[model samples]
Target: MPGRSRPIDKFAAAVGKCSKESAVYGKCILADYNNVHKDKCAAEFMKLKDCYLAAYKKR
Candidate 1:
């Protein structure tokens, strides 16, 4: 029989999804800043952290 999934497994899946989405967004934002705006990308990094934390808390 197939094994049941645990809470940690669900949390890991959520975090993985969030990280992938955040990384894509961060890359775009950082690239735009690097090529055009010349502004710091700290916010994007913080956003990734926030996304992971939110997903962790939600699970």
Candidate 2:
């Protein structure tokens, strides 16, 4: 026998699961970037440069 769950309960369960998954992955990636090497992270920071370029282009 099992108990019934509400729709909101199901939705919250799904969101909690995704946040747990994302935190685990984000920590792993950040630790790898901080410990092993920083080149990949450095390149990732270039997205800001692109953002600035796009803003200037739009103006």
Tens digit of lDDT per residue, candidate 1, span 1-59? 37877878877876786867677667867676746454356666667778877777776
- Please identify model 1 stretches exceeding 4 Å from their true place: 1-11, 19-21, 25-40
The candidate maximizing TM-score is: 1
How big is the positional error of residue 3 in model 1, measured in Å on the Cα after superposition? 12
Clash count for each candidate, listed in order shown: 0, 0
Candidate models: Cα lDDT each: 0.70, 0.51
In terms of lDDT, the best-performing candidate is 1
Angstrom error of the Cα, residue 15, model 1: value is 2.4
The TM-scores, one per candidate, come to 0.45, 0.29
- TM-score of model number 1: 0.45
Model 2 misplaced regions, further than 4 Å: 1-40
